[model samples]
Target: MSIKSATPYFLLNGRTEQAIALYQRALGAKTESLQRFGDVDGSCPTAMRNRVMHAMLRVGNAVLMMSDGPEDVKLPEGGNVSVALDFETPAALRQSVEALAATGKVLERVFEAPWGALFGVVQDEFGIQWMVTSPLK
Candidate 1:
C-alpha cells in the first residue's frame, strides 16, 4: 500500500458541529462520513460517549477531517494550518471570497498580485485559516 503525504485535521475544542456547518456554507463541503463517540460499540470511555469521534468532508478537491477535542485537551493559542482554495474563474472566485469573508476575518481581501492572480487569506470564525486564489487570464 502507498501512503499519501498528509491530511488536514481540525481539532475542534467543543464546536465540531458549528465548524462543520461553517465549512459547508463557505466551501460547499459535503459530509462523507461521521462517527460519533456514542455510536462506538461498547468499550470506549463513557466520558467521550457524546463527542465527535471522527468526521470527513469533501471540499472541492480536498478532504478535511475533524474531531471534537477531548474535554480536558488543552487548545493551542493558534492554529498552524491553512486551507487553500484555487478557483477556475474570477466570478466564482470572487463569490467564494466574499461569502467566506462574511463569517471570517479577511486577512487579505482578494486582489491582483504581481504573480498574476487574485489572492487573499481569511481566518474563519472558528479560527481556521483559509487562503483563496484565482489565476488571471
Candidate 2:
C-alpha cells in the first residue's frame, strides 16, 4: 500500500489543549477528535486526566496531531522541526500571525526576504515553532 499522508505530531508537556484552542482561533482549524489520557485509563495520574492523550486538528487541508507527552519523561529542545504555514493573501497572513502571536513569541517578524517572499518564525505559547510564509507579488 502507498502512504496517504503524513501529519506532524506535536508533543507538549501539559498544554496540548490550549494549543489546540489557539490553532482553532488562529487558523480557523477544526478539531476532528481529542482523547484525554484518562479516557484511555482510569488509573492514569490525576494530573494527566485532563491532559490530551491524542488530538487531531485540521488546518486548512492538513491535519496536525498533538498530545501531552507522558508525565515522567523529560523532553529535549525542539530542534530541526517546524510547521510551515502558507497563506494566500497578505491580509489573511497578517490576521493569522496576529492571532498566533497573542500568547506566542516572534522569532522573526514577517519581512521581505531576499528570496522575494515574506517569511517569519514564531513559537506558540505551548512551545511549538512555526514558519509562516507567503509569496510576495
Candidate 3:
C-alpha cells in the first residue's frame, strides 16, 4: 500500500472553535467543513454533543484537521510537535508573524537565519507552536 497524504490533526481539548478562529485570523484559513458531535449518532456524551467532532481548515494549500477529542483526555504539557509554514516572500512571513503575535507569544522575532532565510517561531493562545519561514531569495 502506498501512502497518499499526511495531514496535521489537532485534538484541541474543548477549544476547537477558538483554535479555528485563531487560525483563520493569523493564517487566513478558511473552514472547509465542520461537524458537531451532536451531528453524529447518539453515542456522544450530553456535554460533548455541542462540541466540535471534526473540522477541516484550508490554510494556504494545506488542509489542517482538528477536533474536540474525548472529554476524559488531556493534552500533555509542552508537547514537542510544531506546525511549520513556509512562505514565498519575507513580507508575507512577517505579516503572519505579526498577526499571530497579536494573540500569541512570539518565541523568536523574525530575523534572517544562518541558512539565508527569514525565520520565526510563535506559540498561539491555544498552545500550538508554529515555525514560520520565508524561502531564500
> lDDT winner among the candidates?
3
lDDT for each residue of candidate 1 in 1-137, tens digit (9 for 90 to 100):
88985678988876788878888876788999988887974667888887888999998878999998777887762388887888887787777677777877788877898899988888877788888888875
Against the unseen true structure, what C-alpha lDDT does each candidate score? 0.81, 0.85, 0.86
Q: Report clash pairs, candidate 1.
A: none
By lDDT, highest first, what's the ranking? 3, 2, 1
Write model 2 residue lDDT over 1-137, tens digit each, in one string: 99998789988877787788899899889999999989999998898898889999998888999888898886654556889998887777778888888888888899998998888888878767889888885
lDDT of 2 at 124: 75
In candidate 2, residue 86 scores what lDDT? Answer: 88
Candidate number with the higher TM-score (2 or 3): 3
CA displacement after TM-score superposition, residue 71 of candidate 3 (Å): 1.4
| Alpha-carbon RMSD to native, per candidate | 2.3, 2.1, 1.7
10 residues in a row with least lDDT, candidate 3: 70-79
lDDT, residue 89, candidate 3 = 91
All candidates: TM-score: 0.86, 0.86, 0.90
